[model samples]
Target: MADVAESERRILVAVDEGEESMHALSWCLKNVVSQNSKDTLILLYAKPPRAVYTALDGTGRREDPSGYLFSSDILAAMEKYGAEVAVCVIEKAKKMCKDLQQDVKVEVRVENGDPRDVICQMAEQLGADVLVMGSHGYGLIKRAFLGSVSNHCAQNVKCPVLIVKKPKTNAFNK
Candidate 1:
């Protein structure tokens, strides 16, 4: 028991609006976190960077593929929406942590940047013992185009990374 108290681990879990991430968090809480020991669960959310749009014709007007101009107000609204999503994700994660284990310590961190970079940076900065996150399970083509955040963090971060894949539910069961 004394050694258990001394061996507290800081587990960092990356969360987002996706159900996959929430599932990872829930799994970590139930399996990795120690109830009798002093363990810290850090929940991290990376709000995407503000969108940067360039005009197709380079006339200083941001235009879509269809040539529809995007106004500054639209950009601002998008940013606001991202912030709101980050807040919601963090709150939901916190609630889940509390519901599962009332004794464990839980910390929340919200950062702005690409999740791949932000999660790695936070894990290093916080000196996490282990990093846990969810895999989106993208196929080869989609992963090639969008890049896998979990895969990038696993390769770059110094700490151990756990990528939890949510089991696919049958449509008929639902």
Candidate 2:
């Protein structure tokens, strides 16, 4: 039992619907995570919170027939979209592992919250040995305005965080 525990490694990778995130996952599969039965790869996707709709007027009076800001149909569509994104990310990660010929166990987790908070909390809860993510490679001013998820994860996660910066190639640039 102790030997099995010793051999097992939990690697958490943050994935999103972006090329940079996929590149990071591919890099982790090929370089960081080992192809072993005891090793597990966890792909985490943080779905943004559902948009809040308000029907209040200037005097805070209800202005819409429905009390809720968003219609039920809109909420349902948003939920479906989030689910689809999660499914796609999981499938892509699995395919990357298969393409690399790595037989590591894979798990998918989809949570709704701030990406930075969710990622940090998940990494700690999972006792991940390493947390892998990709940098958007935003410039200083852009990052300052938009904020950087990779930067936040690195500072807050308990485990070592690997931020993979995608290299620029002719094919990628075009």
Candidate of highest TM-score: 1
How many residue pairs clash in each candidate at the backbone level?
0, 0
Enumerate residue pairs that collide in model 1: none
Tens-digit lDDT string for candidate 2 (15-102): 9889999999989887876545477889899988766665432345445344435567877898898889788877887788778845
Compute the lDDT of residue 44 as modeled in candidate 2.
92
- Model 2: which residue pairs collide? none
Off by over 4 Å in 1: 1-6, 54-72, 172-174
Model 2 scores a TM of 0.84
Model 1 lDDT on a 0 to 1 scale: 0.89
Report the error of model 1 at residue 26, Å: 0.3
Q: What is the lDDT of residue 50 in candidate 2?
A: 69
Relative to the true structure, candidate 2 has a C-alpha RMSD (angstroms) of 4.1
Give the C-alpha miss distance for residue 3 in model 2, angstroms.
Answer: 10
The reply for model 2, stretches above 4 Å from the true place, is 1-6, 56-69, 171-174
Candidate 2 lDDT for residue 157:
85
